[model samples]
Target chain A: MKNPYQDLPATAYWRTAVADPDALDITGLWQPKFPITMTDQTATSGSCFAQHISRAMQNHGFRWMDCEPAPPVLSPESAKTFNYGVFSFRTGNIYTTTLLRQWVRWALEEEVPDSEHWERDGRVFDPLRPQIEPGGFSSVEEMHGARAVTLAAIREALVSSDVFVFTLGLTESWRNSETGLVYSNCPGTIGGEFDAARHVFANDTYPEVYAAMADVIEMAKVVNPAIRFLLTVSPVPLTATASGQHVLAATTYSKSTLRAVAGDLANAFPNVDYFPSYEIITAVPYQGRFFEPNLRSVRPEGVAHVMSQFFAGLRSVGVEVHTEDQQQTPTAPPRRVPTEEETADDVVCEDEILEYYNAH
Target chain B: MPTDDHRFALIGDSNSAGIGRVARSRGIPFLGGPLSNGITLDGDFFDVEDGDFLPRVDGPQAAGFTGLFKAGLPILSTVGFNTQRIAQELHHGFYRPRGLDHSALSDNVLRQAIEDYKPGTVKFYRAAVEEGCDVYAVYSPQRFPEPWMALALRLERLLSGMLVEMGVSLVDVRPETTDEAGRLRPEFFTERENDQTHASDVWSAMVLDRFLDDAGIGVMA
Candidate 1:
């Protein structure tokens, strides 16, 4: 009698797939569930690592939808300083699923955040996206106005996008003790005063993360029934942990929880799929070679490798991967592809600000 | 003109040139008759034969308009001295300073741009202040009654705020020159059909009268 595992592919065995092959040569890491064609309007938001995916999609002549583009007057440098074009909208780094859920609710007019604005040195900041406007807005009215624009953009993006790629970043976040509003960054790190009584640290368990992400998908599908989700777990470890555990252990917990949620969501929803970027970078077979000198930031080569696998996976599924050169022939209109200097290792991670408080 | 031996210098761009034309037409004797003869910050008079009154300075002159400052001439300048150049730059794209309506730029970005793109009127005011000359910055009338002129209006407001912060007196003539709809009144438009970016001599006369009133200088009857 033949066992179920007796005639499996080489990819199913650790020795043939990982142990025997060179780390970089390992294949079949991801089999894309659906085809991501060039014409598909894709919107990306989540951790800083998600930026690479957005930029790569643009660079490859894919239609990476940017609903809230920087005004034409801004130079590329100025646009970046103002946090425009960093993500599909200006909701910088939706690190936690609950924050993602909150943004979706605001976009769909289902919820409103209690904290309107935070003030420091006479300058106002939007509590939802504190660091979006550099040096803060001039007034509370201006902060609200800017947030309204972003919320509108979020709505447009959710409704218009054919694919929404969200890289789940962390399980740990800070929340308002009373309102239960989640902030993108710790209150005091970027703006707002951190009070022990008013602010509370939250390390979401697997169940909470799962439910929030499911709600996000359900809410998005309500607006855009055809929208497909591609989820990934960020490989960059947590910069600091409010949990009493060591930073390393906290990172493992966060990554494991996020990874499990992503896997389960992909299993639960036909439209949802997981890409193994976290495992591709962090797995023992790779020996941590993809990290920078600090052993935290993903190197440019690592990003390139992950994208190669992404494109390769699409091609393996018979999806024609259209390159920029092929998409933009002599008759085609010009499109702006960010230069290598702009996209290379230029992820804006708000959590990295926490490292400033490190005693070491 | 009063012969009190008090000298006055008119400085700025085409709008200032328009004022000079009106003053010349009215036989008013200003130190620089036609400001088309551009005066540098160092007080050197150079003819800008092209009729572009941007006050482009060259050659060996001090950093400040020392000659006119030393003469203690009350300087009447137009806030639009460098606005034409800025308008040309902005034609490449639209950029509004933050806090204004429809603006996407932050104050920090606009502040950084000031070093590279400070208005000529502001620069002139600073030089005159160093020499203790009484300076009056006239807010020029809107050149055109078009939607694109909104940026120009916003820029004028920005410069006006800067001049006020520097304690430079400002003569606002918009109430008289602009219509109820916030456009330049058609009566103040130039005779040249092609030139919409310059006000007529009628507008200059009104501005000059307002400037004279604010400066406390009496015209000969």
Candidate 2:
């Protein structure tokens, strides 16, 4: 036979697929290897953009595995702001591939980094997830108690979930120079004081990030060999880059490196697959309608557009990705699908938080 | 108000069913069939269906409460279902039917077994009392894994407060597995897909023994 593309359909062509970026269905954007049934227990984590994936999954009536759920009494607004029920666990935004690796080791390998709790004005904070407990912990003991449950929940999520979705956010991060502990965000920006020597700004390289991404899937497979991974790169630009490179160049490098890692890993491993959320929001054809006024944040419509394609992409690959909205029982009025903006308010973005400091 | 008709009906969800499982695994002999069907303990032919969580379970298999207890039996459903569906049913019944995520339904068999215990218990309690029986209630924690665990723990606390406001006799069942911290043994309810995952009948019987021993339940006669 000739080349594989010779017999391929029009979906393989750029003019047909890429000619109109405005078209809602970017046919052949992705071809999923597995089906995502409404019954599939999906566990979400990783970058802030990952929350968008989770909300879409929830809105579609897909089972989103929540290892650490908030109390029912807490209003959705309050629960999200308090950093509860946002992710599978309260580990906050796992922005960097490096940090994601650290969490996997801690949860799966019993490797707890030399722990140090940051205290400010008599409030204790977990450097790994500084904003998890809104007001910060009252005591180191209290912080330890809460983190214990979170760690247990993380372990449970890893083992219980059928599919794990992780959105690669950045290649730049802040790490503990001494212990090699990866902090969620720059410490000084959130809770802890910045000691220049103690805190080192790390711009993870393509090789390192690529290795960590593979390690994450490998580690997850050890616990649940059947577990599948759906990888996406956050389209959100860098809030601020600590690297010596210009902020725009830093963002381009960070995203491209993470994107390459996702594509390569998906190519390397059968269980690993990549979704084109980055292309959906940032691709030139959509006229940049998905971004907010700031040009940095994804717009609500853009988030919606990405999710719509998410399911569509899976369907293109012969996956049985059904929306509960289509077959809902008639007894009740069709439930409202939460707009991306409604869900966005509750998003926990440490990078966007970093942008807040620069806003003033 | 308590009488020689010391008959009782269990009203809770799967935790309540755990007793029957324990009863059956050990072949605990009773007057009728499995408790989910019918059973007569201590000469009281309990209408097993009224209390069991299984669907369509009722008095036909055994003696209906009216037939067995001419003087009627107090209804006490030992509810300890820690689930988001029941929690949402009680707290936010509005967004239900489609709004509720069905994935939780598949992972935890008990999530489908979720009943709005507050109203269900009250309705069961009133119906029992109207039949000339006394009414009592009990609240306890069920060991659950993940997402359900946190919600279940919080719901348990909420259920305790509910028992107080409703003025129901709150009997706290401490099975052999429960510790001083009031936490149930996590293993008792883990691996919930299997029938034998909860506390054994011997452990639940300790709960029955505790119920009989409680001062609130004055009709030991």
Candidate 3:
């Protein structure tokens, strides 16, 4: 007898029980196992999401290669300014796969014809991490030297690091004209000229994204033979979109394409793996527990959820979970408090203050 | 006991020396500086026994040489008013090792006073060794560096062991009145709105009360 529910298999019915209603399955490309583990001195560099990964590595007892760190002794204001992370300095938003590719290519010091260097502020900027200073680099030479040294140092550090955790942040980025280098944030975010001619936005396709990741992974392997790559698409929605499309649609498209690319790369490269950080935060039915009041920064509970999955993945593969629970969480960026609107209830007369003070 | 024969030294910095008008009214005499009737009881000069300052008396008070012999305490040479005067006396060949760069500029002056006024501690200890005599140490208000408090704690441990060698116990006023950050406790100030480290009349009375408590002395009515 023919089964009545033949077309929709019993397995398909189970999706309602476990899977997110919005979960789009690119699982055919790469369905990760429960636990995965790798022992590599890891370095994270990318967009703001990369901060989370850096923190996670530090928390999880993973060897975090702080390729660059601000001087240990610094005044609070100096510490705030010299923002340390990737390459021991804050180079805002290393968005886009091509930019990520450029970072790896430059870090390896390989001859990539598209390499462009600029002098601004006191340093040089490669397309991978452009020099962002308020007034711009002092001279072209200083800028170029800085870029060269930064690239050289990163390559040197990568040669010894085992894992490179790259978080795909934005598909939109600004590129240089004569030299095809990428700038992190636009010049104005820190301080520089915002000339449209000097930059082009990269709304990359999935194939382009895949190729970029493959190139970086290949390049990283050359530096460190055992280099493993893990990719996660940042769940942070777009602040603005250059794609002329609706910002919401553009965000979906950007995330979807990157997610597809990540799946493709994980399938293609045995050493590469995809973590469901974006999924855990966005669609895992975790409710709204993860995001801060501003809908940014994974709430402590959300971070715990992600870390739990991460550790579960490690445990499944027999990787020892470093038992430092206290250190396993990274500090979240400060939440922006909304100002309360003034109402009649807030209005207090000066006479009241004097009256109260005298009585007290 | 003869009140004229008695000497009462209040040693410290400008704060201890009674800098402001509000601080001047404490019953202690202002021996080191010129006197004007800033306030009635706050005369700018101390009533003296010879040249050295003596405690003031409102009534007839007389005694004999036997009281001095019985007390066996050192002749109190009060230098509480100004550290500068104490620094001068010690540096002007009073102590063999000149009070130059002893620790800090402030500590140097204070240590100089200690050396120059050995008569007070020595005589007090001699009297108290077999019988009973009153001796006290007081710290004046000053802003101390936060980091130095920790260093001072360690130094105090070292100083404590050395104090035994010197045959005396040292009392730390820091723990009693300093806030956690090593600043003088805000509550200690009566005239808090000003920059004065000098105690006000109320604060002076409070400090004097604490001193009498430690010295086992009754306030002279």
Best candidate, TM-score: 1
Per-candidate TM-score against the hidden true structure: 0.77, 0.57, 0.49
Please write out the lDDT profile of model 3 over residues B2-81, one tens digit for every residue. Answer: 35433333322234323322223445332222111111111222232332234232212111122432333332211232
Clashing pairs in 2: A290-A299, B11-B77, B12-B77
Candidate 3 chain A — worst ten consecutive residues by lDDT sum?
A341-350
Top-DockQ structure, candidate number: 1
Residue A226 error, candidate 2, Å:
0.7
Q: Which pairs clash in the backbone of model 1? A: B41-B64, B41-B65
Error of 1 at A214 (Å): 0.8
Number of the top-ranking candidate, with lDDT as the measure: 1
Q: RMSD, model 3, all Cα superposed?
A: 22.2
| Chain A: TM-score in each model | 0.90, 0.86, 0.73
List, residue by residue over A1-360, the lDDT tens digit for candidate 2: 698788877777877777844466565677777777778789999889999888788777778887876534334555576676678887899998888888888888558644788999878888988887666776776676667666767878889899999999989888888888888889889889999989998898999999988888888888998899989999999989999889899999999999999999989999888999999898877777888889899988888888887888667666665575764432423334544532332132212222222325
TM-score for the A chain of candidate 2: 0.86
Off by over 4 Å in 3: A1-39, A75-80, A86-90, A112-145, A187-190, A287-289, A326-360, B1-221
Better candidate number, 1 or 2, judged by TM-score: 1
Compared with the true structure, the alpha-carbon lDDT of candidate 2 equals 0.63
Worst 10 residues of 2 chain B by lDDT: B37-46
> iRMS values in order, in angstroms?
19.6, 22.2, 25.3
